[model samples]
Target: MLPISALSGAPIVGRATVASIRLRLPLPEQLPPAVRDHIEAHAGSQNRQYLYVPSPVIADQDASAPLCAFVSIDYASDAETELVEVSRGKMLKSFLKQNFSRDADGDQILAALFHMVEHLPCYLLRYSDVVAAAQALETAFANGDAPSLMMPVLPAVENVELGWGDSEPDQPLVRRAQATVVDLEGEAFGVSADQRNIVHLDKGALRVLGLFDVRTREREVVDILSAAFPTVDAAQIENDVSGAVRRFRRAGLLVAT
Candidate 1:
């Protein structure tokens, strides 16, 4: 005997089976719209609530985005809800950071992704599928493969009291955040300090980030990069440098103090 109305997390694996007894009944507005509709139309019986696990499965037109966030949350538990929120925060931060790194489509892409998340349609999943998915997610989280955005546990915060260091009296201090993240040679993915966004570091971006150093200024960064590639136009170099800084700032990797 299983309690009906249990929604398995967004089924990334495939279609799943969910048990529910359909009936004809009038629903009320007091309940969430999704809940009401399911009962009124499908009539899956109403006393118990359903779980809508917010997943990080980004579906492309005919492709699959990375399973960036946790598999799902119980929603009924406070701690699980908190965990889901942290995962979502990391998802957003990662999204914004990746888009910001590209051309001007960053804001638009994020808005669309969030909209998709909010309006995600719930589906019924099979019991076996649910168990399997849950097991997989549990393993990922346990093995530190899933993106929880949690930092080093035993170690304390960096030496910088505010996470950002200070410069001379008049310099616009732009240094890397105290956190030392990986450069990820292939394709890198990370979240912001607060886990509200994601950061993707490609080779080109890594080239720019490689400029970070103590007491480094924006102009110095530009000069260093320009010196490396003496063929490109000076104006283009400035634009490229500015764009990279803006992206880094948004990603919380480099803060303008």
Candidate 2:
């Protein structure tokens, strides 16, 4: 469990073993000497050790402005795991003031900051790659060349039915299940499940899954998402949705329409 201070949005100020660090981009070589020194002084002695850096909450002056970064970090210890937040805006501003010329363009600075943070280690899937692929898919959709898509869940195989008397009638039942793809020879692979082996779903992918209806068209789904998360970029959402669909399809959880 995280300290109540951290849970309530206070800066972490102690030693912790991190499981992962998700930065908007990797640490830049040109970081302000003070900030870099602070990080190095604070970093664990072990090489490649995970460090948690929380996603900073930005108060956008313009409500219509798009977010530049959404980074997160996960810390794991023998007892539990916690996420530590960092402010991307403050971090970038510190670096820019220290490293760049005052005449630098705002867009250029933002781009540079994004590029710098983009190098953080990702254990499973790189969100930047997902965003890139999503951009390409968005282009295809705009060109009226989007592919037909479908969402499929695990299918019933060799069902073992249960009777109503299996448990108390008024008791609420919680179902925990796992699904795996089996080859022609009945060998299983690509297993995902709840409880001990839950598959990880990023925010965008979770949203897509929530909106998914079997055999739903990509365009229609995108439209629905546009209405739901009005502040988010449609193209980015589309990319995340398409990426999840592709992953599921590859895992045999989805099929082409």
The candidate that achieves the highest lDDT relative to the unseen native structure: 1
> Per-residue error at 229 for model 2, in Å?
1.6
Per-model TM values vs. the true structure: 0.36, 0.26
lDDT of 2 at 112: 37
How well is each residue in 1-257 modelled by candidate 1, as lDDT tens digits? 11111111222221123334332223222355664554445433243454332222433333322223323323221122122233333343444444432332442333344433323322222222323445545554564432222111222223333323322223444545543443222345443443333356666566766666465676776787789889988789877767766666655566556
**Local distance difference test values of all predictions, in order:** 0.42, 0.37
Q: What does candidate 2's lDDT look like per residue over 1-257, in tens digits?
A: 11111111222121232333343334545456765666666554333534444323433332221222223423222212222334433333344454443554443333333333332211211232333433543543354431222112223332333222222212322221343322212212232331111123445655554444344555566778889889999888777656665554433333333
Question: Which regions in candidate 1 have their CA more than 4 angstroms from the true location?
Answer: 1-171, 183-185
User: lDDT of candidate 2 vs native?
Assistant: 0.37
Model 2 segments beyond 4 Å from truth? Answer: 1-198
Which residue pairs clash within candidate 1? 16-126, 17-125, 17-126, 18-125, 92-197, 93-196, 93-197, 93-198, 94-197, 94-198
